[model samples]
Target: MVFEYILKKNGLDPSTDLTIDQSISFGLTAAAFTSSDADYTIEFEPFATTLELEGNGSVVASLGTESGYVPYTAYSARKSYIKQHPEVIQSFTNAIQRGLDYVNSHSSEEIAKTISPQFKETPLDKLTQIVERYKAQDTWKEDTVFEESSFELLERILEEAGQLKETVPYKELVTTEFSTKAVK
Candidate 1:
C-alpha cells in the first residue's frame, strides 16, 4: 500500500499497470536492513523468466513468526526508530491498519478463499481448519496503534542502515479512525 501510495502520488495508475502486494519486512533498527531478500522476483516481460534472489542482509529482525518464537529484543529497537524517522511513520501505520482491517472483517473461510486458491488435496476443508485455528489465537487486534515494542524491532534495522530522518512520535504515527470500517 505504501509503495502504491507513492506511485499514486506520482500520478501512476496502479491497477492498470501494476499489481503489488506490499508486505515489507522491516527491521529492529535503521541499522538493520534487507536487500533483494525476497525469494523471488520478476522481470518486465509478461513471460519473462523468473529469478530467485535472496539478495542480501540478515535473515530476519522481529519475532520471526506470528507465534512469537525465536525471541529477540527487536521490538525495542523498532520503537526507538520511530523516535527518529517521523516522515515514514504514517505510511508504516497505514499499511498495518489496512491489513488488520481486512483480517478482522473476514471469516477464516472467506479470507482463506480470497487469499489463495491453490491449496492441495482436500483444500476447502483444510483451509477452513486452518482459519479456525487462526481465529482461536489470542490477542488479535484490528486497530492501528503504533506500538513502541513493535517499532523497536523495526528501529534496530533501519537505524543500522542510517534510514531515519527525524525520530517519530508514536502518537503521531497511528490512529484507529478506520478500525470500524476496516473489518468486514
Candidate 2:
C-alpha cells in the first residue's frame, strides 16, 4: 500500500507504470528478486540489508522515508477490551515507551548487540549496520503517541490504493490517553 502510494506520489500510475509481483510470498520477496529479472523489490530489514551484503541488490530507497511517518506497527485492542482493561493498556504502552527510550538513548552498535540474539543467523557487524541504517533514517519514534496527522495520512494512502472503503475518524480509532500518560 505504501509503495503504491509512493509510486502515485511520484507521478506514476502503479497499474500502468510498473508491475508489482504480488505472487511472491512476503518472506520470499528478497529471494525472488535476487533470482528473477525484477528491477526492484520492497523488503523489510535484515533481508534488505542481507541482499545488499550479498551483492544481490542495492538498497536504493526507503519506502518509510518516502511515505513519511506512518505507524505501521501499533498496539491495538477491541473497544470493549480497552474499556475493561485500561490498566493493562497503560502498562503495555508504558513498556513500549520504555523500549523507545532505550533505543533513543543507546548507540546503534549497542542496540544491535542487545538485539543480536533475536537474529541468531545474522552476524554482529551486519546487525550493527542494519541498526545504523534505521537510526540514520530516524525509524524509531521518540514516544508512543500516534499523531492524528499520521493517521490521516495513512487513510489517504489507503484511499489512494482503493483499500479504504470508509475513513475512520482518528479520535474513533486512536486514543492518546495511555501513551500520553506513559510518556509523562
Candidate 3:
C-alpha cells in the first residue's frame, strides 16, 4: 500500500509502470531478492535483519519516517463478536495496553532479552537491533486509542492503492469505546 501511495504521489502509476508480484511471505520475498528473481522487496525489521544476516541485501528505502506509517500493529474483532463479548474485548485491549506500556518503559535490550527465547533462530544482536530501531521509531502507541490523522492517512493510502472505493469515516470504521475503557 505504501508502495502504491509513494508511486502515485510521485506521479507514476504503480499498476501500469511497476511489475508487482506478491510473495507468500516476507522470507520468500527476501529469498526472491537473494536469488535474483526480484529486484526489490518491502520488508520491516527483524525479517530485514534476517535478510542482512544471510548477506542477501541491505535496506535501501527506510519507510520508518517518510511514510508516516507508525503504530504498525492493530487488533480487531467482528462487530457481532464485539457486541456479544464487550468485556472480552475490553480485557484483550487492556492486556495489550499493559504490554505496550511495559515495552515503552523498558529499554530495547531488556525487551530483546525477554522475547529472544521465542525467536531462537534469530541472533540476540540482530533481535536487539530490530527492537532498538522500532523503539526509536516510536512504533508502539502508549495507549490503545486510534489517532484520527493516522487513520485518515491509512485510508488515503488504501484509496490510492485502489483497495478502498470511498473514504470511510473513522467513527464508522472504529469503535474506541473499549480502547477508552482499557486505557483508564
Candidate 4:
C-alpha cells in the first residue's frame, strides 16, 4: 500500500503505469531483486544497503520519505487487553519511548554496534550505513505518540489502496494515553 501510495503521489497509476510484483514475499524482495527478477524493489534496511553493497541494485528512493508520516510502526492491543492491562501497556510504552530516546541521542555507529547482535551476518559497517541512511531520513519519530495527522495519513493511504472501506476517526481507533504519558 505504501509503495502504491508513493507511486500515485508521484502522478503514476500503480494499476496501469507499471507492474508491481506482489507475489514476492516481504523476506524475499531483496533476493528477487538481486536475482534480476525485478528491475526495482521497495525494501527496508538493511536489505537496501545489502543490495547496494553487493552491486545488485541501487537505493533509488525511500518509501518512508515519499509517503510521509503514516504510523507504519505501532503497538496495538485488544480493547479488553487494554482495559485489563493498562499498567502493562504503560510500562511497554515507556520502554518504547526510552528506545526512541536512545536512538535519537546516539550516533548511527553506536546504534549499529548495539543492535549488531541481532544481525550477526550483517557487518557492523553495513549496519551503521543502514542506520545512517535511516537517521538522515528522520525515520524515527521524536516520541512514540502516534499523532492524529499521522493516523489520518495512514487511513488515507489505506483508502487510496482500496484496502479501507471508510476512514475511522482518530479518537475511535487510537489512544494517546500511554504514549503521551510515556514522553512526559
Candidate 5:
C-alpha cells in the first residue's frame, strides 16, 4: 500500500503502468526481485535487511524512513472480546510494555542474541544488524499511545486502497484505557 501510494504520488499509475505481483512471503518476494522474476518488491525490515545483507537486493526506498510513513505493529481483538477479556488484555499489554522497556534499555547485540533462538534460520550477525538498524530508526515505541497522525495516515491508506468504505473515528477504533493502565 505504501509503495502504491508512493507510485501514485510520483505520477505513476500502479494499476496501469506496473505489473504488481504479490508474493506470499517477503523472502520469496525478495528472491523474485533478486532473480529478475519481479522488477520490484516492497518489503519490511528484518527480512528486507536480511536480503540486503545476503546481497540479494538493495533497498530502493524505505517508506517509513524516507516517506514519513509511521508503520506500526499492533495487537487487536473484537470489541466484544475486549470487553469480556479486559483483564486478559491488560495483562498482555503490561507484558508487552515490560518487553518494550527491556528492549529500549538493552543493546541491539544483546537483543539479537536473546531472540536469535526463535529465528533459528537467521544468523545472529544478520539479526544484530536488523535490530541495530531498527533501533537507529526508532522503530520501537516506548509507549503504547496511538499518534493521531499515524492513525490518519493509516485511514488514508485504507481509503485509497478502497478497503475502507466509511471513516471510523479513532476513539471508535482504538481504546487507550488499557494502554494507559498498563503504562501506569
Candidate 6:
C-alpha cells in the first residue's frame, strides 16, 4: 500500500538495480537490508517483530532528525517500549496531532459520509467511534515525509553491513518536489 505507490509515483528507476527486501518479514527489520544496493524495500509486518528485529540481529538506522515509523496501534507493551526509548516515536505524536486536528475540525456525520466508501468493511457507527478515538488521541503518522537525511541513514546502515556495492544518488532515490505538494 505504501511502497508501491510512493515508489512509482516518484519515478524510481527499477530493474537494473532496483530490488525490494520482503525477507525479514517486518518492514522495520526488513528495512535493515536496504543498506545494501537494493533499490527499495517493503516488509509490511513480520507478522511478528520477535522474529524480525531481535534474532539474527538488525541494524537500527540512526535517522538523526529525518523522522521515523510508529505503529498506529502502539498501545501494546512492545510498542510502548520503542516509543518511550528513542528513535522517532515523537513523529507518532506529530502525525497524530495532524490527524486528530483533521477529525476534530470535521463533523461526525461529515466524517462518516466521507470515509464510508473508503472502508466498506467498517460499519458507519464503528467508524464513528474510530474517528472519535483518532480525534481524541493520535496513534498513526501516515503523513510524515521521507527526508533525505533518513535515506542517508539507510545508506550508512547498508555500508556498515557490507551490503552496499556502490552508491545510490539522491536524485535517483527521492523526489520531494512532488511529495511536498501534499504537505500541509
**How many clashes (backbone N, Cα, C below 3 Å) per candidate?**
41, 0, 0, 0, 0, 4
- lDDT tens string, model 3, 21-127? 87456557666667776777888667787777778877666675667853467677899999999889999999998988889999888999999999898888888
lDDT of each: 0.44, 0.93, 0.80, 0.90, 0.79, 0.47
User: Model 6: which ten-residue window has the lowest total lDDT?
Assistant: 61-70
Model 1 residue runs over 4 Å out of place are 1-85, 117-124, 144-184
Say which candidate scores most in lDDT: 2
The CA lDDT at 107 in model 5 is: 99
Better model by lDDT: candidate 5 vs candidate 6: 5
Looking at model 5, the pairs that clash are: none
**Colliding pairs, model 3:** none
Q: Supply the TM-score for candidate 6.
A: 0.31
Candidate 4, residues 37-71: lDDT per residue as tens digits? 56788888888998899888899888888888878
Sorted on lDDT, best first, the list reads: 2, 4, 3, 5, 6, 1
Per-residue lDDT of model 2, residues 1-184, tens digit only: 9999998899999999888889988999999998899999999989999999999999999998999999899788999999999999999999999999999999999999999999999999999999999998989999999999899999999898888999998999899999999999
- What is the lDDT for 39 in model 3? 70
Winner on TM-score between 2 and 5 is 2
lDDT tens digits by residue: candidate 1, 1-184: 2333334545777788664434433322211222333432222111111111222332221113332221122122255665576446545556667766777888878866875555543356456655554556533465654356655545444453357655666556544333333333
Model 5 local distance difference test score: 0.79
- lDDT for 124 (candidate 5): 90
- Which pairs in model 6 have colliding backbones? 25-46, 26-46, 27-43, 35-158
Please give the lDDT score for candidate 3.
0.80
> 1 or 5: which has the higher lDDT?
5
C-alpha RMSD in Å of predicted model 4 compared with the true structure:
1.2
Q: Write one digit per residue (lDDT tens) for candidate 5, span 42-160.
A: 87666788678778777776677654545457788999999899899999999988888878999999999999999898889888988888788777788776767778888887788
Pairs in clash, predicted candidate 2 = none
* Candidate 6 lDDT by residue in tens digits, 6-71: 334357543333665455545355446434564333332221222233453332321211223322
